[model samples]
Target: MEESDALRAARAVRRSVLGDAYVDGQSADPDPAGREFQDYITSTAWGVWARGGALASRDRSLLVLAMTAALGRMEEFRVHAGSALRAGVTDEEIDELLFQIAAYCGVPAGVAARRVVRAVRAERGEA
Candidate 1:
């Protein structure tokens, strides 16, 4: 299949934010349906990420962290949290964001996000 310019741009944005290693791992061998889904996400979701309008990539990363955490998507939360950190979001900022999440999304969500953040930090040798 020919890749559209949008898909190519989105894939580059995804690699920049999520890291080449992670993107490469995700692109490694998939069944037909899975490959289609991956392409869909790369073109759509990552396309939004690639469009830098009012929000910068770091802002988008932080927003993703909050939204994923509030939705109890811990794995996604962890991924975005790591990306947020790499995008120049401070540990203190993430800590404060957790407090905000606790206040708005409930304490459980905040706690779960903290756990994910801790694991991500540990993985990066930050903890």
Candidate 2:
């Protein structure tokens, strides 16, 4: 892909994964190593991730939430999981995703997700 394509892909990941909390619009660093890693994340990973594949945006977001939850990164989950809902992912879908994570992301992660999901839902009157 082109450099512009790389940049666009990275931004999409940032917007969808990071929501409004990310303010680092520029590249990570000027060093070659940082550029290489960014390339890998933008071109190789995110690029190859959806190439010729067709999942709805909500599905993709759900997958991301599950993975992040598995890592026990509660802060990240609280945001992106809300983003996933905003992207049209349903509470049921998120619940299922969290269930899957519990099998892999552990009970604590799923439990934490439940609390967050509940709070966000309440904020939207979905509680």
Candidate 3:
């Protein structure tokens, strides 16, 4: 199937925030179902990212981190933590966000998010 303009814009936004390597890794190879899921996320979630609303990309990155952490989606939290750094979210801001997560989402969720953020920072040599 041909890629739609929305998909193209979504991909550009996703790549800009997440980096080409990560986005390409996600696109590598997949069964039909997986491909469809990928396309859905690219066109939906990333499409919103492409829209450039009042929130800047950095703001959106932080929001994703917080939401994923609150939901206990540690893998996704890890992924977004790296992207958040790339998008200009400072480590201090992330640390503060973790505190907010602890207050609202519970201590365990905050601890899990901190672990993911630490791992992400270590991978980037920022720790």
> Which structure among the candidates has the greatest lDDT?
3
Pairs that collide in candidate 3 are none
The lowest-lDDT stretch of 10 consecutive residues in candidate 1 is 28-37
Q: Per-residue lDDT for 38 in model 1?
A: 85
lDDT: which is higher, 1 or 3? 3
TM match of model 2 to true structure:
0.63
TM-score of 3: 0.92
Which regions of candidate 3 fall more than 4 Å away from where they truly are?
none
Ranking by lDDT: 3, 1, 2
> On lDDT, who's better, 1 or 2?
1
Clashing residue pairs in candidate 1 are: none
C-alpha RMSD of candidate 1: 1.3
- What TM-score would each prediction reach against the true structure? 0.92, 0.63, 0.92
Q: Candidate 2 residues 73-118, lDDT tens each? A: 7886887776776567877888788788878867888898888888
Model 2, residue 29: displacement in angstroms? 13
Candidate 2 — which pairs collide?
A: none
- What clash count goes with each model? 0, 0, 0
In model 1, what is the error at residue 79, expressed in angstroms? 1.1
lDDT of 3 by residue, 7-121 (tens): 9999898998889999989987668877888889899999988887798888989889889988889988888888886788988999999999999999999999988888888
